[model samples]
Target: MSGDDGESTIQRIQDIVAVFVLSITAVLTAWCGFEASKWGGEMSIAFSQASSARIQSTAAEGEAQSARQLDLSVYTLWIGAKADEDDRLADYVEARFTPWFTPAYEAWVADGMVENSPFAREEYVPPGTEEAVELSETADEKFAAALENNQRGDDYSLLTVMFALVLFLTAMSQRDVKTWVGRALLGMAVVLDIVGIAILLTFPIKI
Candidate 1:
């Protein structure tokens, strides 16, 4: 072929490759944006759940504290009545013990005071203690999930940026420039596209 024909063929090939790269990069960029948005939503949901669990845990803990105080006060009153030799008042206080407190008090008495006081016994589980622990654990898991979702969103955002760079390079490659420079830019764009796609494939898809 003549020199002009040969240069024309090269130009045509470069245009084709540049157009293909631009199309693919545009799609990848759009997909990355979509995934990032989805991950962001997941992060929001997880964070909201974590917050709710934490609040519930706090409320349950409050209930437990209130129960503990009430039980302590009643037990103290009973002790005072006993010290004053008022069996009737002591019986009244014992009868008024909360159901949960009664179990611990019974266990304490059954064990022959091996554990000091009812409050000191392992059997003295306050109301809502188990619920508070479970809710706190759930909150921790949800918070961790939120962090992971945030990280996933960031990864997609990073990939979107990378695709944008590929688009820029592909567009630049289509510009009028020295033959080698255009080819170099195109080659770089293609390589970056491959890397971005590989990374994209490794990531978990939301939709």
Candidate 2:
């Protein structure tokens, strides 16, 4: 073919490629939005399920604590003087007090003298253990949520990146300006990643 005819064929191919790239990018962006919405719903369900399971578990454990008791002698034995009174008191309280009351009383604090009642005394007990357990439970819930969301988010991210790559392959893909839009889309992807990270950080409460 003549030189002019060959140049015309190349230009036609470039135009076709540009159109294909634009179409692909638009489809990917729309798909990402759709997937993100779907992921939000899945995460909500996971949160609810996990929360319910944990509350049920806590109730069951509390019930188990309520069904046992120590005879007076056993109670005395458990509460008997020991070098480390705290251990003795914990055992004493666990043996005699009702499940609901025991943990609370065990955590109480009296005077500086440190009189811990096995059954019902005052002492300072840190709530961090309970909080940690609760936070761990919450974290599990959030992690499950993130798993669902991130999976979908990852798919969206992959498509977005793939579309960007397609744009790069086009001769008239608007190198400088469309590049800005691509960056914006990338920034949105980063936002999704940050959200997943936040869920992980807040899930295990700092106690």
Write down the worst ten-residue block by lDDT for model 2: 198-207
lDDT of 2: 0.52
Candidate 1 local lDDT, 1-207, one digit each (tens): 999999999999989999999998999999999999999999999999999999999999999999999999999999999999999999999999999889889999998978767999777888889999999999999999999999999999999999999999988887888889999999999999999999999999998
**lDDT against the true structure, each candidate:** 0.94, 0.52
- Model 1 has a clash total of 0
Task: Report the C-alpha displacement of residue 14, candidate 2, in angstroms.
Answer: 1.1
List CA RMSD, all candidates. Answer: 1.6, 12.3
- Candidate with top lDDT is 1
> Model 1 — TM-score against the truth?
0.92
Candidate 2 stretches with Cα past 4 Å from truth are: 69-148, 161-207
